[model samples]
Target: MRFSNYFIPTIKEVPNDAIVKSHILMIRAGMIRQLTAGVYSYLPLGFRVFNKIINIVREEMNSIGGVEFQLPGLSPNELWMESGRYEIYGDDIFKLKNREMVLAPTHEEIFTTIAKANLNSYKSLPQIWYQIHTKFRNEARPRAGVLRTREFTMKDAYSFDKDWEGLDVSYEKHAHAYRNIFFRCGLKFFSVKAHSGAMGGKDSEEFMVEAEAGEDSVLLTEDRTYASNIEVAVSYREPVGRKNSNLSFEKFSTPNIKSIDELADFLKITDKSRLAKSRVFVNVKTNEDGTKTNEYILALVCGDDEVNESKLTVLFGLGLRPAHNEELPEITGADAGSIGPIGIKNPNVKIIADQTLKEADELVSGANENDFHIRNIDLTRDVNNIEYYDIRTAKDGETIPGTDKKLREAKAIEIGHIFKLGLHFSQKLGAYFLDKDGKENPIVMGSYGIGVQRLAASYIEQNNDENGIIWEGEISPFHIHLICVNPKIESTKIFSDKLYDELGKKGYEILYDDREDIRPGFKFKDADLIGLPVQVIVGEKNLNEGKIEFKLRRTGERFLIPENELIVLLNNYKYLFGFK
Candidate 1:
């Protein structure tokens, strides 16, 4: 591809709105143009890199027995309703104006629907269906270019299996494929145990690359052995409560002490272990008759610990959320600031406490009255209908469970996720298969996804310098960037033209910069900015010496290769640079 013929409108200055390295460099390299706030148009150069990554993903998935499909991106609302994710996704999903259709952010529902239509029995026990397609999400704050876009490309796959064991095997296959894809795409990433979120899966793992602009927080041990997404991460269990078999409590007036910090300060308590923070939640269940039943719950955690809503939601249900301010008065008899289970006005509200508080004694809690609190409390004696679970967010510096190593945290971009979906989608959508015994059972499932654009941006996040992006491995826009330093010079142009043709004949994907009237200095800067891993410079001075300059964009290493020997060196490129 000649630069003069191709349409890469390279910019000298970075856009003011771009913040992350990928966003800044992509624009200057003329890789993408912003069509809207969160939408973009990939130029010819960008599309080449994009398609290369897709091809790599395609090859890996195909190796894992994945069957490719081109499903419609717009799905009917009935599919979402049947899966019970229509309300859970809320405003994050893109829906049509009439609310009858949706632009799928993920393909689990549609794939399950398709599985229900085709697969018959255990004969189709395990099948991986995949597609490389665009997805839509209504991101409230889309930033860092394609890293967080409303419209982007994704490689989504779903596996149908007969049972849990089959699902596990299918899940591992996707995991293996994901590892290969990331490695070939030049992305440095680690997998973390993650919550399935709205996907409603049993266990999920996220492949993430560390970056400053990342929206997800991941915790890792010193050896990087144990990793988890902060939402469901449990580094270690905190010891908080004293063993109190039976204890008593007394109500006390504590005016304007709403928050745990404020209450700790009011009581002059520095440790905060003796103080308990309470939160009220309501899960509204929609019945078959179109009526709703509201179930209220009271959650308790140690004063210093923070509540992880994801953990809570996973424990309860998707409808579980912090109760509204107005509804709190009706459910708990008091507002959020002073609501607890002890002597609570509501009898039906279930009390769920953090595991650390099960044996806790002499703990302080709310009085269930305005401007008042209860002290010297024991949960075993004072609270009824109580259960213990891990509902608190993991804090940094906490020791990993069963290991002395403390957890370290970093922000990372999530590139891929694979889920052990079990029977969540199949059961809900009535996708069942019959076994040899002739018993119809819900098909176990596994869902895997790789965000194509996110992978591109994440590669840039890890492999870039002040000059520009380092297009390495299979994701490079071009294998070689051949520059004609003096296009106006007759001898230089002739030599460069000949070399360009030779490079093409040698099976090198070369981008020839043969634009006349462009200064040598500008061409050099543009070459650096474009950042194709290998650069071949043909100049008048080098032509006279029977030599040409070869530069590596990544290492900035330059070599003076004899003009005739250059093609011989190019033949050894695959072993040296690992380019396609």
Candidate 2:
């Protein structure tokens, strides 16, 4: 590729609206242009990188017996309705054609539909089907460039098996394949347990890359052995010690004692052990008759902690949100700030508390009346109908479960996910196969995904410096950037042309700078912006010396090699960048 003729636009300043590093660098380097919010057009350079990533994914998937097909992005609404996801998915799905058709956010339903029509009997026990196609979702707020696009490309794979054991094997196969794909792409990622969320599965895992600008929060142990998306990660601590049993339960007249901080200050207690904070929630469920019921959930956490809704949902097997104003009176039987679990008579209400709170013998709580509070309250004596569990985020110095390491936290982006669906889709969609005993059984299913474009953005997020993107070698747009410091000089031109041809023959893709008017500094800046793995500088001075300067994009290491030895130098570094 000749740089002069290519549409490689490089900008000096970052865009004002770009908050993430990848978003800014992508726009500044001219790799992509925004067509609208959450929609973009990948220019020539960006497309090249995207294609390379896709090919890598293809090779890895094919190695594991994956059969590729092209599935339609536009799916009929009847198929979704048959799968029972149309109502559950709500507005996130893009419905079209006067609410008759829909754009698929994923292909599980479509794939299952096709499988049911064609596949029957035990002979088709295990099958891996996949597609690299466009998916659409009506994201309420799509930001950060391609990271959270409303319409983007996805590599979604579905596995069909006859039973649970077969499903496990198929899920493991994809997990192994995904690891190989990300490893070859040179991404520093971790596989964390994930919530199925709207996907609806019994088990799921997400591959994440740590980044400050990432939307997801990941909790990690100090030793990095146990890590999970904050939604599902569990933290450990010694059970809160029980106080003396003789402490009396008494009511205290405390005014405007609504928050934990306020209660702590009013009590003049340095330790949070003396306080219990209660949070009100509403459990929303849709019955078969299409009626909605709001069940009030009062969750109690330690004064120093916050509720993790993901853990709550997983424990209860239902979706929950903070209580709304209209539902509070009927559910909690009091105002929001003055509600308590003590002496509550509502049958439609449930109370749950963290294990740490149950161990407290005496503490402070809401009085279930306005402008009043309870002090020296004993859980065993004052609170009734309570369930105990770990339902809050771990503090900084808290211990990690099953390990001695202290807990730590960071923000991260999820690039890939693997899940053991276990008949969630097959049962709903009636995708079944006959067993060896001639019995009809639902096909066990597993789904795995890798966000190809998001990986590109994550690369920039973790590896960029002050200059621009520092692409990892395996996934960089090009293998080598050939720069002609003075393209007008006959010797410089001849050296660059020969080098480019030599590298090309040696199986290295080269981006040759053939423009005559651009200055050396401009060429260097553009080279850094595009972030090719290796740079071969052919200037008039170097050509006269019978040598070329080889600079590595990642390490900033530069060395001089004789012009005749360029091919050998590039060949040696090829494997280092995952080219084998």
Candidate 3:
């Protein structure tokens, strides 16, 4: 590829809107151009990298017996409705043409529909079907370049099996493939247990790479044996310890002290273990008849802890959103931040408490009245219509369950996810297969996905410097960045052109900077900005020395190799550029 002809169009100044390092570097390197928020056009250089990553993923998937399929990006609403995800996805789904179709955010339903039609026997079990295609989601906030985009490419695979054991084996194969795919892409990532979210699966694991601009929070233990996404992370919180002090059913005249901190300060009480924080939410469920019903929920957690809404949604197996402030007054007869479950006026409301507050006694909470609070309330005694579950968000420094070491938290980008889907989609979509015993059973399934574009951006996140991207050798768009430092000089141009041709003949992918219109300084900056694994600088001074300046993009290591020895050194050095 000749730089003069290629459409890189590298920029000297960064875009003002570029926030993350990857975004800035990608723009400056002329790899991607933003068309609209969360949508981008991959230039020639960027698309080359994208294709390389896609090929790597395809090879790994193929190695694991994956059969590639190109599923449609737009799917009918009936497919989602049959799988019972039309409403669960809610506003995140991009509905098209009077809600008759949807841009697919995932292919589980579509794949399952295919399986139902063709895979009708136990002998067809253990089938791995995959596709590398576009996916769409109506993201509320799309940021961090391609890290969180509304439209992007994804490598999604679904496995069909006859039983749970078969599903486990299939899941392991995908896990193994994912490890290799990311490893080859030059990404440093760790896999952790994760919540399946809208995917509706179990035994889910996410491949995460730590980055400051990451959207997901991951919890890890000291020994690294336990790791999880914050939505489903668990920690050993200390049991609430409190003393009743002989105060029973006492109503205090707290004026305008609604929040736990405000109430604690007004009462001159520092310990928040005795304070109960109340939150109201509404769970919307759509019935088979297409009618929707809203269920009011009263959730209580220790004042020191905040409710994790994801965990609540998973536990209750429904779609939930926080109740509006105005809706609270009508349900609990109280204003915002002061609604409690004890002696609640709404009899139809379902009340649930965090497990941390189960044995807790003499807790202070809202009195369901204006400017009032109740004391000496026991959850086991006073709360009604209540259930107990772990709904509090896990925090840093919390002890790990069954271990003394505390949990540490970090932000990370989720590159890939594998799920033991079991029979969620199969059962809903009637994707069944006949077993050896002649019994019809829902096909056990597993889902695996890697965001190909996000993986490329994650590599940038993990392997970049101030200059530009440092691509891993195996995934670089071009292996060598051959720069003619003095293109105007005939000798330099002739030597650089000869070397580029020789390198190409020797099975190397080279990007030759043969543009006579650009100066040496601009060429050097562009080379650094593009971040090829290795750079070969052919300058007049080096030509006189019978040597070429070789620089490594990653370590900034430079060496002067004799022109005749270039091939041998480059052949040996490419192995050292990317993942070991």
TM-score comparison, 1 vs 3, better candidate: 3
Instruction: Give the clashing pairs for model 3.
Output: none
Pick the TM-score winner.
2
lDDT score for candidate 3 against the true structure: 0.87
Tens-digit lDDT string for candidate 3 (1-580): 8988888988989799998988888888888999999999989988999999999999999999999999998889988888878977888999997758999999999999899999999997789999998999999999988888899999999999999999889999999999999888878789898887765677999999989989899998867777789999988887785454545677778889879999899879898877899998888888999798988888888989999998988976656889998888788888865677776667898989888887577888988887888888877667665798999999988977887877889999999999998888999999999999999999999999999889888889888888888875678999899999988899899999999999999788899999987888989888989999899999998899898999988899999989998888887886844534
Worst 10 residues of 2 by lDDT: 336-345
Task: Give the residue spans of candidate 1 off by over 4 A.
Answer: 98-100, 243-248, 287-290, 571-577
Quick one: ranking by TM-score, best first?
Answer: 2, 3, 1
Instruction: For model 3, give the 10-residue run with minimal summed lDDT.
Output: 241-250
Q: What is the C-alpha lDDT of each candidate?
A: 0.87, 0.82, 0.87
lDDT of 1 by residue, 439-504 (tens): 999998888889998898898889888888887777888889999987899999999999899888
- Pairs clashing within candidate 2: none
